[model samples]
Target: MSERREGALDEATIEARLKAELPAWRYEDGWIRRTYKTAGWKSTLMVINTVGHLAEAAWHHPDLTASYAWVEVRLMNHAAKGITDKDFALAAKIEEVVGWQPGAEGGPLEGTPTDPRFAYVKYDR
Candidate 1:
C-alpha cells in the first residue's frame, strides 16, 4: 500500500495560525473547532450541506455536530495524529463560504435573505 505522508504542526504554531487566520475557531482537545449559529433548521441543513461539499472537495473531512439552529465543525488530521495545514486550509474555506455576506454598493442585490423566514442568521459575528 502507498503511504500517505503528512506532517502535523506543533501546538504553538497552530495556536498562532488559528489566532491570525481563524479567529472564530477554538483549539481544544487536539482539534480546532468553530460553531456557526444559523437562523433555523432549514439554515442548519444548508450549512451542513455546504460543509459536506467543501469537505468532499478538499478530501479533508471534519467532525460536524448540528442542532436545530447551529452547526459545529471540528477539524484534525487523524492520519498525521494532530492538526496540520490541511485542517487549517479546510477551516479557512469553510469560514469563507459560511461567513460570506453578499450585497455591496454595486454588488448583486441578490444576497442572503434579510427576511427572518429564509435568512441564515448568524448569532456570532
Candidate 2:
C-alpha cells in the first residue's frame, strides 16, 4: 500500500477552522460532525442519499447515522488520521445540497416546482 499522506490539521486549527467555516459542525471525538433534522422519514432518506452521492463524487466518505427524522454526518481523513481539506470540502458540498431551498437564486428548482413529491424540508434547530 502507499504511504499515508500528511497535513492533518491539529485540534486547535481544526476547531478554529470549523468555527469560521462550518458553524453547524462540531469537532468531537477526533471527528467533525453535523446532524441535520428533516421533516420526516422520506426527507431523512433523501438527505442520506444526497450525502452519499456527494461523498462518492468527492471520494471522501463520511461516517453517517440516520433515523426517521435526522441524519448525522462525521468526517475525518482516515489515511491521514485526522481532519484534512477533503473533509471540509465534502462537508461544504453536503451543506449546500441539504440546505438548498426551492426558488432560491440560481437554484435547480427555480420558480418553485409544484410537485409535492419534490418537496423536502430541512428541520432548523
Candidate 3:
C-alpha cells in the first residue's frame, strides 16, 4: 500500500484521537468535520468569523458551510492530502473557543443571558 503523507495519521489513529480528544468531530470523506449549531443567523455568522480568524492565524484553513443556524467545518491538510496534526490542532481550538461557557465556569464572566432572545450558540449540554 502507498504510505500515508508525512505527518498524516492513519485512519485508526485518527479515529482514536477523535474519540479521545474531540468527541464533537467526526472523520468523514477524508476530512475531519464538526458542525456547530447556533441559535440563529447572527450566531452562525459569529461562528464563521471566529473560525475564519483562527484558521487565518493558524494558516490552515477548513471548508465551511453555513445555514440559518449551523456551521459545518471540515479540515484536512491539502498539501499532505490527508488528515494531519494541523487538522486536529485547529479542530481542538475551534471546539474550545466555540463551546466555551463562562457562566457554567462560575467566574466573573457571566456569559450570555439565558433568555432565548439573546442566546447565541446552543451550547452542548
Q: Tell me how candidate 1 scores on lDDT.
A: 0.87
Runs off by more than 4 Å, candidate 2: 1-5, 106-119, 123-125
lDDT of 1 at 26: 89
Which tens-of-lDDT digit does each residue in 4-117 have in candidate 3? Answer: 887788899999999999998999999999999999999999999999999999999999999999999999998888999999999999999999999999989999998999
Tens digit of lDDT per residue, candidate 2, span 1-125? Answer: 12334868888788888899988999999899999987679888989999999999998899999998799999999989888899989998998788766576675657435466655655353
lDDT: worst 10-residue window of model 3: 1-10
TM-score of each: 0.89, 0.82, 0.96
| CA lDDT of every candidate | 0.87, 0.83, 0.93
> Which is superior by TM-score, 1 or 2?
1
Clashing pairs in 2: none
Which parts of model 3 have CA positions greater than 4 angstroms off?
A: none
Candidate 3 whole-model C-alpha lDDT, 0 to 1 = 0.93
Runs with alpha carbons beyond 4 Å of true place in candidate 1: 1-6, 104-106
Measure candidate 2: CA RMSD: 4.6
Arrange candidates by TM-score, highest first: which order? 3, 1, 2
- Candidate topping TM-score: 3
User: Cα RMSD to native, each candidate?
Assistant: 4.3, 4.6, 1.3
